[model samples]
Target chain A: MSLELAVLDWFFEPLQFAFMQRSLAVAIMVGIICSVVGSYLMVQRLALLGDAISHSVLPGLAIAFLLGVNIFVGAFIAGVISTVIIGWIHTRSPIKEDAAMGIVFSAFFALGITLITTIQKDNKIDLNHFLFGNILGVTVGDVRDTAIIAALVLMAVFLLYKELLFYSFDPLGAQAGGLPTGLLNAGLMVLIALTVVASMKVVGVILVLSLLIAPGATAYLLVPRLHQVMLLGAAIGVLSSVSGMYLSYYVNLPSGPAIVMVVSALFALSFLFSPRHGVLVGPRRGRPWQKLRTLLPSKGS
Target chain B: MATSPKIIVDHLSVNYRDVQALRNVNLTVRPGKMVGIFGPNGAGKSTLIKAMLGLMPVVTGRVTYGDDTLAHQLDRVAYVPQRSQIDWTFPATVWDVVMMGRVKKTGWFNRFSASSRQLATAALERVGMLEFRDRPIGALSGGQQQRVFLARALAQEAEIFCFDEPFVGVDQKTETVLFNIFRELAQAGKIVMVINHDLGESITNFDQLILLNKELIAAGPRDWVLTRDNMTRAYGGHVGFFGHVA
Candidate 1:
């Protein structure tokens, strides 16, 4: 087959399968949502929140599976509960943000593992789909659900973008200004819960952190403005998803890790070459040769 | 806007588990007045402010704003907490931080409007930080960060402003600039309450003083409440740190 034919064949091959087509649609929408909300989480220092939440949902999923319910519903319920509990504990306790997060996540994860091993001994359910998603078998229901939740998350974030930024940086000031800090906090937690549940089916729990953080963090390095960061992050995420899907289809590899690897590569390139804050830019404002000439004073001392 | 007592704290007491952070503190701050709250370490200055702002749960006294309770009139009073109490590494600009002050004014379901931006800019300008509005608040100097907080409070445009040690960890120039801005707010009929550590500076700068040591030691005009006897009572001994008492 010709190279062009191979490329065309790979693209058309996915459309031939209903599951693959649904997965592609779901992945694309999820990529946009994860990148958009993920950028805010990364910037606001809530990067680990997605991981913490995904881990906490394990028990909920195990119970739901044992009870013959949809794992997504189980995970969603668990996600919202855990998010609220963590936020409340962190705010009320003397423990700082990171320490509180660690305590809540570990305890919940340990409980989840225990439940999974003890209660689901029959093991009829394949939990691997939650850890490393099977994009090849995404159902139409999953796509519809993911689309609705992603749209809601996007709307909530954009509507309260100003308040979120404000409260994230200055909670005290937000409270004093009567901005309903507590309510905004709870709303953001709900958004986190929804995002985790939506992205889990695309990137899986293990690799979802990359989907939730890498593109946004990388975009931050490239852009100096918040709006630009969001736009760049979305573009990076969608591009990474498309490229990773193609690479996985051709090479017959896992979709989640492939997407993360592509995104990581983009981050690496930006780290080395971005103009605003790249490692290569350093503290100098000119080319290395120009800087060296200036130091050498051209022909004179 | 009106020349009335905006904040009134009546027998406010805050307990943390077993320890009593504040004990029966009573204070009344009028509009267009600069009230300085001074105390040594662990003197419940921050606790009092927290209780007033409903940030503390184990508080047993009522905090009122003008004719309404603080719980009912939250938007009328503003708080500028200690600069050291927050984590600055969170990603946000000075403008973003100040824009939060308008959150209450704009309410929910709406993004910060152009009017909010105007308020934020004007507040930044009042603090002489108009040029640094776009800078990430974490990237600014300690003084600049404090000024950002001040700008946030200014943007709130609350009738009563409570600052918990804005001068702490700041340069002399920043301290003066903060008080000058406080003076401007007071002149515009806003009640400005600043919790201070420097007794001498408070005595020289403020119009009224609320001396506290886990309780209300003295509350009156600076000259009457800032006496050496009142200092000895509030400090309870040789308050050598900031020379409150010899």
Candidate 2:
């Protein structure tokens, strides 16, 4: 076969399976929503909050499964509940926010594990599937659900762009300027919870923070504005996710970890090569290898 | 813009968790005047301002502006919090920060109108930050950051202007710019209030002084509020004024 034909064949072979198509669609949607919502978390220094929300969703998932409810709604409720509890603990006590988040997430996660373990005895469900996603097992319904979440999240972000930007940048100033800061905060919390719930199947709760933070953090290094960071981060996220899906099909690796590795690698590459704030490249305004100039003999010397 | 009214904070009290931040503080900030809030450390200068703006929950009294409560009419107020209260490293350009002033006026779910852009542009130019509009806020110096915030306040075009510690980290040039704009705002029949802890020569810039120490010590013209008795009362003893009064 010709080289082009072989390449095309390799790519086309995966689409032959309905499962691959569904997983890819879900992955793409997860990628976009996670990055957009995660940009807020990353900027607010709430990356750990993402972890807290993701893990806290497990108990809700197990309970929903027992009660025969939509797991997404349950997961979202749990995520928001965990956030509120974290806030309550931090405010009502001298214990700081980080400590509160750590305590609440662990307790919820432990309860989730116990619940899932007990439920697993009577059902065919596996805890590993939730901890590490089984993306290839996603159905057409998963694709539709993920698409709805992505559309809603993107629309909310677009409509509330200016308000969210102002609130996230300066909460007190936003409050003083008559922005209804409490409502805006609750809206953001909703956006975050919805994003976390949508991302649960792609990276699982264990690895969701990577999908949430790494892409946005990477784009942050390369951009100078919040919207720019979110846009570039979405692009990075989508590319990494789709490529990871392809890599998994060809390399026989787990889809979730493969996606995570790709995004992490992208972050590492950007961390060292970003034009303005790179370690080795220094800055692109000068030269790509400007830092290497130190090793070379100087003309003045 | 014909005549600005006074902000009547009547017997206002505030608490910080358990401790009393401000107690039964009663003062009136008049328009067409530059008012300075001066106090020592932990003297509730910021708290008094916050309580007046309804940023904190009051325990005792009401802060009324005109006929309505001040909290109900926050749109007429422009507040620039202390430099330490903000996170400058967040991803925002100078233009973005200044445009936040228009967010309230433009309303929600709507794009900024042309007049909003014009106001933001004029504000940036007023503070000499028009050239740095595209610069990331985190990349600016302390004074430049403060200037951007001042530009934001100017863009607000509010009836009441409140600044908290605007001079804490600014340069001489920025301080002069701030005071000049403040005086101009006061001349335009606008209410300008600033929280400052400086016992330096700049105390003379304010037309009125509000000396505070958990409560209102003295409030009136500069000389009247800077009496030796008031100073001793507000600052515990062994303290000096700006050499303008005993």
Candidate 3:
């Protein structure tokens, strides 16, 4: 009976602090939106684009701080700009999309680091918090901002679900069928940018990719349909976020990395145990050992 | 049902970077006929269709259906890109893909109606893929995948149909199923155009042929387009005379 009470106390203690409440709210909102939008990236094989957009937002955030504007607005603009530049470079030249992404992201990331480091020397900003999120430091306003972004992103995804599915699955066919693929592509970029901006306070730039990709990918192994993947992924993301927050409170770990580690651990568990696609218990589970043995010469030889 | 329009291409040209992929191409496709666009590798067979549908930038002229530009009337058209262009591993069941056909007709921000669901089901049945409706697209064989796309086009209920390389890696059963549906669509007075690279037995299935090699070599009935001189012009001097060789 005492042990049960202690467990309950461990869970309830964090709710006492207003800062913890804000952080948990922000984490949950970020968790839901990131995975829902990230399912599109996973299905389209555009995971790197998520990374590019996340890194590109740093310069925008820094610039917004300098100009006294909402940092999310600045981050969104920078993310959109990076995508346009990447598209321009890929379409106008022979450089492939991946190379364009790599070039644009690294350049933007470097510029962001330089700008943030310079500002940090004079201002009270901590570069570490920006690179690896400061979830515990999120304020009530930040929670509200995340909620608005989350609502907008989720609404857009819901309304555009069918179009996005068609466009991402077969772009040329969708274009040929008279779907405005260019508009769809741009709208998708906007959704991705909003998601990345909303996520920055919870996972930071460097670790955001795991939050954006791992949940959806893990759900992909378990679900057969796109909407199912999104649903399951959002659930997984929310559970991980809340549990990671409690783990951080109890074990004295950084909240952002702890959340990421929890999400990664969940992905690993799915990777090894999913019924249809798992590495350890799937259809061809034992065949690898047999194949490996076949590679060796027999005793007669 | 709306009457299918007569397709007219007037002096169409296409360029990729510095090279002219298609030059001074012209053709006329009337309703109630299966038109096959055949060419060798890099012959711009796909480019011609893409340019006509406004999928690619046209360099010279325009494509029209009856009184309207093809681009403006795209809602009445159904197109299937090459199978290789699609990501089969995408997380969608066959039912989900077939429902995509109803997306345009259901309009933006509107849910698919019950009639739309019935149409999708009928299309799946038409292609003999009703049993696999719930299966993931990636798990199907190449032939089954092609049939699913064909079912999607059928569900669109469009007046014009365009297929790019529908027979590349499909089995004989799928080819026969596809050709039967193409013939039915043509018989119903819908314009049917298919991009084909093979000069095999399937060549005889088309009612009209548009033989091309960067430019229009021949565009007419099958017998006229498959002439020795036209074959040599399109395939570049490596012709062995076949059954209808000129």
Score every model by TM-score: 0.88, 0.96, 0.96
- Model 1, C-alpha of A153: deviation from truth (Å): 0.7
On DockQ, the leading prediction is 3
Residue B76 in candidate 2, Cα distance off native in Å: 1.2
**Candidate 1, RMSD to the unseen true structure:** 4.6
Q: Locate the minimum summed-lDDT window of 10 residues in model 1 chain A.
A: A292-301
Docking class of 1: acceptable
lDDT of 1 at B19: 87
* Candidate 3: residue A140 Cα off by (Å): 0.6
A best-first ranking of the candidates according to their TM-score comes to: 3, 2, 1
Candidate 1 Cα errors over 4 Å, as ranges: A1-17, A85-124, A284-301, B171-173, B239-246
* Model 3 regions lying over 4 Å from their true place: A284-301, B1-3
Return whichever of 1 and 3 wins on DockQ. Answer: 3
| Tens digits of per-residue lDDT for model 3, A1-301 | 6999988887889999998999999999888998999999988889999999999998998999999899989999999999999999999999999999999999999999999999989888887887899999897788889999999999999898889888999888888889999999999999999999998888898899888999999999999999999999999999889998988898998888999999999999998778878776666656646644665686776
Candidate 1 iRMSD in angstroms: 2.3
Q: What is the lDDT of candidate 1?
A: 0.79
Write the number of the candidate with greater lDDT, choosing between 1 and 3. Answer: 3
